[model samples]
Target: MVDANVMKKTFTVPEIKPLDQYDFNRAKVCASVRWLLAKSYGSAENVPADLREPVLIGQELQAGVSVLLLSPDLYWRAHSQLHLRGVSQGPGQGPGGVSKGPGQGPGGVSQGVVQGGDHVALLQLLASRGHAPRDQDRPVTVEDLQHTPIKTRAHLALIDALMSLAAMETVGRVKMAAEAEQIGGGSPWENALLFWVNRLNQRLRESTEDDDDKTQTCTDLQPAQPAIRYRKDKVQSKLTPTFPLVSGVKDLSNGCAIAAVLHYYCPSRLPLEDVCLKDTMSVADSLYNLQLIRTFCCGTLQGCCPLAVEDLLYAPPTLHMPLGC
Candidate 1:
């Protein structure tokens, strides 16, 4: 960073703000993108030395990011320090220290295996950056780059890490960073309810009409929901609507809504198999689902602001904005 010099015709360009869309012309064609990364991470010194270099928009960023992801620590650190914004302390040196130096993959193994904690951190960071792998069930092992068992996990994670970086580069910052207030008097719950209802109506084969504040299965409805059009023997079959009707705010007490919404937004974080469309029968059931939602939001969905089970269950007016957004 240097002072603007009228003598040299060089002008001061502000650092690309987080969540704000990057100005391609100034960011790439003119200004060094290294300044943006440095500023984002706090200072040039705070930025990890490994990734401290000028980068253009395309191949340069991709190549640099891929090389960084091979070790896990650098790429995770870059996003954590540069993007997570107090969400996490980046990837920690888990059970084993991360791999360092070139040609240090499988051969230099002793301290390179990514442990369970690191694996979770990587996934959370990646998923939060909207770069989670499509294949969610598969686990990242202690031997990601350390050992090659049929397939290399490094390449798989590389794609995620690279795309995650790209997303961080392009994602738009939230509107009105200076001051945030609910636009209308208060309509977050109603707006969220309408948005979900309308969106699900379009995508889902059919949705339960959640007209009342009652916990009831699809069968319990006064009139059965519509069946899907597809058929096995030219005869239409009734598709059981996994997502039940959400009448009022309390209807989301079960972790079902969180799973469904987050799954829809970021499917890699919460797979379709994990979403339970059923309503909670008891407090234990609600808590179990709520815990899952909390982990998903706080860990997997790293970008989203953390919300507690009480906040979610109680359906407070304060949460209307978060829910709607």
Candidate 2:
């Protein structure tokens, strides 16, 4: 069974002062992006020392590898929200019509392997930042995160890792196909990449199935509830399924987080699968624009250096929000 208290506590919009709370606003995030791009182009420490040798010597090489690296962090933030905030009701509800489980259960681990890596990385980074509790720092609080900057190099490193992983998979898969003339010469890198890609795809598909089963169980077992808040405004007004404890902040973030998991696990490869980038972009935009989500992003940025919520929000081909702003 899901913990109602945890959901009630985490799902609500964390109270925060407006611009004062977040160190890096929209502009600072943008600048950090340029810095990342410069590092990537210059080959000036963009790729982690630990990962560089493997990446350079890999079987399938990608022209722009940073994209893969970024994915893990993005998915981590998204998955963390999903993990923390279980769906209350409506479209994202679980099987027994009860709240979704917190840890690994029917609806858990839906995020992909790469995303899992990001979750681990995020915790390590947070621990280094002091946001993560130590033996001395027993309790965790928003105040602990208040002064920290959202932007950090670690986030950029994470993005690069995700982009690299995806690229490695794509290139590996591409190399596996034998042309009429080159049928005899097998590419080793291609085979290796295919091995992992196939595994990832299968795992993600199964996770989706698990989610479906949970959803079915919830709907079948529980009776539907009444709407809590209704208003004329399209944006502010509540639609249905008024669970008293769960706040709007928690509800929306949970939806966005689930959507993020779906996105990371099921990214549509260009010239391969037609995963709608536009749709994903729209979701990212809407989530960042929300005051609550922006605050959460800012919170995640706490103690991190050189990376900010703005960087994620304004990435080109994503939002295309102006850099100077």
lDDT of 1 by residue, 1-325 (tens): 0111211232222222332443322222112224334433434455566565444453234345345344545434333333333243223321123333443332122243222335555566556655554424554443554342322334344333443343333222423221212222323334334335434523542333342223344675464433432223232323343564554445566666656666667766765444334332344445555656766755754324223455455444434323332
Q: Write the per-residue lDDT of candidate 2 for residues 1-325, one digit (tens) a residue.
A: 1112222343342333344443333333333343343333222243344433322332222223334333443334332332222223343333212223344323222332221243444445444433343223243322322213322334433333323333333443444333312322323323333333344444545654454445443455664332222222212221122111111122222223322323344343111011111113243333333333334323443312232343333333222111111
Least accurate 10 contiguous residues by lDDT in model 2: 269-278
Question: Model 1 compared with the native: what TM-score?
Answer: 0.31
Worst 10 residues of 1 by lDDT: 1-10
Clashing pairs in 1: 19-172, 19-173, 20-173
Question: TM-scores for all candidates?
Answer: 0.31, 0.21
User: Which candidate comes out best when scored by lDDT?
Assistant: 1
Judged by TM-score, which candidate is best? 1
On the 0 to 100 scale, the lDDT of residue 12 in model 2 is: 40
Clashes of each: 3, 26
